[model samples]
Target: MQDITLASAAEIAAAVSSGTVSARTAVSAALDKIARLDPRVNSFTDVVAGRALARAEALDAARGRGEPLGPLAGVPFAAKNLFDVAGLPTRAGARINRERPPSERDATLIARLEAAGAVLVGALNMGEYAYDFTGENVHDGDSHNPHALGHMTGGSSGGSGAALAAGLVPLTLGSDTNGSIRVPSAFCGCFGLKPTYGRLTRAGSFPFVGSLDHLGPMARCVADLALAYDAMQGPDPEDPAASPRPAEPALPGLETGIGGLRIAVAGGYFARGGDADAFAAVAKVARALGADGTVEIPEAARARAAAYLITSAEGATLHLDRLRTRASDFDPAVRDRLIAGAMVPATWVERAQRFRRWYRDAVLRLFESVDVILAPSTPCRAPLAGQKTFVLDGVELPVRANIGVFTQPISFIGLPVAAVPVRIDDGLPLGVQVIAAPWREATALRVARALERDGVAAAPAAILS
Candidate 1:
C-alpha cells in the first residue's frame, strides 16, 4: 500500500475488483495520507475519513458477494468545498457559509461519482466565494502548493489541485468560472478538464457566477481525467444550465491520435502578457503535436474584460442579500469587489452581455478552421506563498488577478480546455491549454493524451520536502 496513493484511479479500481486490494485498504491509505501529509499542504478543509472507510467497507462487501461494481469502484476522491457534500456545511471557502445547515444530499456530481463506486474523502479549501485566482484565503488558512510547499496553489480550486499534486487522491472535482480549474491545474502541475459551458451539471454546488460557472474533474493523468469526466456527463433536470443533449463519453476516443485533426497555437491576445516559461510550455506541446500554424482569436482581450464584468455582476447579484446583511462576514477583498460590482451601471453590464454573444461567434468561426488551439495555462509557475507581486513583461503585476491572464479569454467564450502539464528541467512545471470547440472535450483530451504518451507533458508526483 506504500505506492497506493500514487496509483491511478483505474489501477486502484482494478486491484479492488480482483480482490488483490480491498476497498477498505485503499480508502484507509488515502485517509492515512491525509492525516499524515495534509497539515503541511492544507489541501482539505474537512476530512470525511469515517464516511470514506464506511463506504469502502460497503464496497468490499459488495465485491465479496460477487456483485458488479462501477468503473471507479473503490477509488478515493474529493471535491472542492463549493461542492455540497452531504453531512458537511458547504463552506465554499467563506467564513459565513460555516453557519449554514449541513447539506442533506451530495451534489449531483458527487452522487454520480459515488454511483460509479468512488469513495468521498473530503471537501477541499478554496478562495472565498470562488472569487480568487491566488489560493490564499483569509478565513481558512491558505492552501499551499504541493510541488513547492511555500508557493501558491492557484484558486478557487486551490485545494483540489494541491490535493491531487500531493498524491492525496487521484481524482478531485473543481469549478472553473474564469479559470479556477485550469489555473490550479497549471500551477500545481496536474491535468484538469474544463468542459464547455452547460456540458456538466452545476446543481447543488455553490454559485459564483451563474452564467460563467462550470464544474469538472482534475487528475494526475489524462486517462484518469477522461475517466471521471465520462462518468459525470448527463443532463440534470435540477440544473437549468445543464445541457439537454445526451451524454457523450470521452474515454473511448481519448487514445485516438490527432492525425486528422487540425491543431494550431493561439496567437494575438493569448500570445502576449505571459513570461517565457509560459510560452515555452505551449510551444513544447505544439511541437509534440506537430501544430506549427497559429490561429488568432479575434477580440480575445475584450472578451476577457466582458467575462470579468459578467462574473462580478452575476456574482454580486447572487450574493447581494448576504453582502448587505453580513458585510464584515466576508473576506474584505471579495466583499469589496462584490460591492463595487453591485454598483456597476446596468448599461455597462448590458453591453458586456451583448459583446459576449459576438465574441462566442467569432471563436466558433475559428473552430471551423481548426480542431484545437494551444495556449498557455498560466503566465508562470507557482509564486512563493504570501508573495503578492510578479514581474510580467518587465512590469510588476498583482499575483492574484494576473495568474489567469492566459486562461480567462478562452473560458470567456465557454470553450472546452484541457490543461496538460509540461515539466521543465530543474524548474517547476507549467501547463498548456489544449482547447477545443464547444462540446468537443474528446478532442482536447486526445491532444493531452498524445502529449502524455510522448513524454512532452506530465504531472509528476509533487515532492513535499
Candidate 2:
C-alpha cells in the first residue's frame, strides 16, 4: 500500500471508496505518523486512537457491504482543543478547562465532517482561550512550526497549521476571531479558510469573543479546504449566531477560475507595514491573477483597533466567572489581558461596536466594484518561538498584538477569506488572503484555487528528520 500520510484528503477518500485502500489503512497511517512525529511538533494534545480505529473499521465494513461512501471517505482530521470531542474535555488551551468532564457530544462541525466520512484522530493544541496570536501556550506548550521547529506556528489555530504542514493529517478545524486561522496558515505554510462569521455552526465549541468568533478548516490543498468546508455548511439552531442561509458548496465552482472576477490588491493600510516578504507574497499572487488595480479600505487602522477592543471586552465577558476564581490557573498573559478587559468602559465597547457597523458598511461598498481583494495573511513568516518584538515599517512592535495587522480589518466585519500559502525560495512560507464579500466564500475560494493551479501558491509538506 502507498503511504497514506502523504496523500491528499481527496486522493485518500477516492482510494478508500474504490477499495484500493481500506479506511482502516488510511486512519492507521495517520495515527502512526502522529505517534512517531508529534513529540517534535506537539500538534496533538489528545489522540483518539481507539475511537478513530473503530470509526475507520465501520467505514471499511460499510464499503465492503456496497454502501455508498461519503466525499471524505476515510480522511483523518483533527480539531483545535476548543472544539468538543466526545469523551474528552474541551481544553480551549487553558488549564482550568481541563478539569471539566468529558463532553457527551462532538461539536457540530466535527459531527458534520464525520458524517461525510472523515475520521477524527485527535484534538490539537492552541493558544490559551484563543486570545493569542503567537502559538505559545503556557499550559500545553507551543505548537512549533513544522518548517522550522524553533519558530512559532501562529495561533490559536497553531496546532491545526502544524498538523497539516507536518502531514500528520490532511485537514484540521480551527477558529478565527482575530486571524487565528489565517495567521497559523501563513506561518506554517498551509491553506486555511476563515468562512464569514457565523457561516459555520459554533455549537459545542468553547467560546472566545462570541461576536467575532469563526470556525473553519485548514488543509494542504485548496480542494481539501473546500471539501471540508462543504461538508460542514448549513444552519444549526443550537448556535444562535449561525446563519439561516442554505449551504452553498464551493467545491463545484472551485475550478471555475477567476476570469470574470475583479481582483485588486489592498493599498493604504495593507500596502505598508511588515517585512518585504509579506508584500512580495501578495504581489506574487496579484501578478499571477493579473491583478493590477489597488483599492484602499478607509479607516482600516481604526478598524483594527475596534476589533481589538471588541475582542477584549467580549472575551472577558465570556470568561468573567472563571476570571474571578481560577486566575492563577490561567496563562498569566491571557489572564492579564482578560483582567484588563474587565475594566474597559462599557461606553468604549459601545463605541467600538458602532465603529464596527460603520466599517463593515464601508468595506462592503468596495466589494461592489471588486469581486475579490488580496492582502497579506500575516505581517511576516514564522518568528522564533518566544521572540518578543519585530520591526514593522521600521517601528518595533510587540509580535503578538501586531501579527494579524492585515487580517484583522478584513475579519473585523466577518468577510470570508481563503489564506493561500506562497513558498518563497527555501525560506519559511508566507500567506496571501483572498477576500470576498460576506456570504461569498466560493468567490474567495475560486481565486485561491486559481493561484494554486498557477504554481503561485502551495503548501508543500515540511521535511522532518
Candidate 3:
C-alpha cells in the first residue's frame, strides 16, 4: 500500500483498466497522501478534493458498464496555475487577474487530458506570469522543494515540480520558456520533458513570452512522461502555433536500446558551475552513455547572453502595458527582471534571433557527430531554500537566470531535452539533462530509459539517515 502511492500513472492506469483497482480507490488513496504530506511541503496552492472524487466515481461507473476508457483513465493529474482548468480562472499566481472571470473552458491540452480520463486534482502554483526562474512567487507564495523543506523548487512550474516530487500527483503539466519545465524537474528529482517548440499545443494556456512559451508534461518517471505527452501532442486546428503535422506518439522508442548511438558530454560552462555535485551528476550520465569525448558549443557564453536578451525583451513587451497600469499587482521577486527585459534594445532581440539561427546550426552540426548531448540540469541542488546570489565557478549571479545557464542556450536553439534525476545524496535532489536533435525526442527518451534500466537513477532517498 505504501509502495502503491508512488506508482507511475502508467502503472496505475493499467491496474485501473484491469479492474484490479478502481478510479475511486486510487483517488481516495492519493488524496489521503496529499492530506498527510502536502502540509509539510506546501507544494500545491489548491487541492480539488471534491472535484477529483466525483470524476473518479464516474470513471468507476463507466468501467463497470463496459464503456470504452481513455489512455489515462482514472489517473490523477494537475497543471500549473497558468494552465486554465475548466471553470477556473487562470490566476497565474498574481493579483491583477483576480477580477478576471473563471476560465470558460479548459486549455486545449487540459481538455485533451480530461477527455483521456485523467482526473484533475487541482491547480498548482507558479512564479507569477512565469516571469521568474527561482520559484519565488511574491503573489502566490513560494513552492518548496519536497526533498528538502527550506529549498526553492524551480519555477514557474515550481508547484508541479514540488507536488510531483512529494508524490501528490503522478503526472503534471508545466510550461517552459527557457527551463521552467526542466529546471524544476531537475531540482525536484522527477522526469520533465520540454517538447519541441510547437510540438505540444499552447492554446488556452496563459502566455508568458508568446514566442518561447512551451507547455509540457512533468511526472515522477519516464514512462509517465511518455503517457502524458502522447496524449497531449497532436494537430490542433485552434492553435496556430501547434504543428499541423499529424500526431506522433512518444511511446514507441521508450523501451528501445541506445546501441550504436553517438553520445557527447558537455563541459566548459556546463561543467564548471555552482556546486561540484552538479558536474558529477552530468559525468555519471556521460559514462553510462559511453560518451566519446566533449563537445563545446563555441562561444556558449555569448549564446547565454543572447538568450537573456531575447527572453527579457520579449517578456517585457508581452506584459508592458499591464505592468505599467497595474505595477503594484506584479510579484516583486520577478518585477525588476521583467522590467529589465522590457528595456533590452530591439536590435539586440534581432541579433539574438540571428544568433539563434547560428546556434541551431552549430547544435545540428554537433548532433551529426553525436546522437545525444548529456549536460547538467541545475548547477546546484535548489540553493538552500530562500538564499539569493548563487556562486558559479566563484562568480556570483542573480538567482533567477543563473540556474538556467546551461538550459537557456539549448532552449534558445529550440532543442528537446529530457531532464532525468541523478543522485545528489546531500539531502537535496539533482538531475542531468539529455538533449537530442529536433524531432528526435525518441532518441532522448531512449537514452533516459537506458540510464533508468542500468540503475543510474536511484529511487529518491532510499536510505536516508
Best-performing candidate as measured by lDDT: 2
Candidate 3: segments with Cα more than 4 A from true spot: 1-3, 424-426, 459-465
After superposing candidate 1, which stretches have Cα over 4 Å from the reference?
none
Query: lDDT of each structure?
Result: 0.91, 0.93, 0.81
Model 2 Cα displacement at 453 (Å)?
A: 0.6
lDDT of 1: 0.91
TM-scores of all models?
0.99, 0.99, 0.95
RMSD of 1: 1.0
Candidate 1 has its poorest 10 consecutive residues by lDDT at: 456-465
User: How would you encode candidate 1's per-residue C-alpha lDDT over 1-465 as one tens digit per residue?
Assistant: 458888999999999998999999999988998999999999999999889999999999999999988999899999999999899999999999999999999999999999999999999999999999989999899999878888999998999999999999999999999999999998899999999999999999999998889999999999999999999999999999899989899999988888899999999888889888889888888878999599998988888888888888888999999999999999998999899899988999999989999988988998888999999999899899988899988999988878888888888878999988897666878989999999999999999999999999789765662
- Model 2 lDDT per residue over 105-193, tens place: 99999999999999999999999999999999998889989899999999989999999988899999999998999999999999999
Ranking under lDDT, best-scoring first?
2, 1, 3
Q: Choose 2 or 3, whichever is better by TM-score.
A: 2
Clashing pairs in 2: none
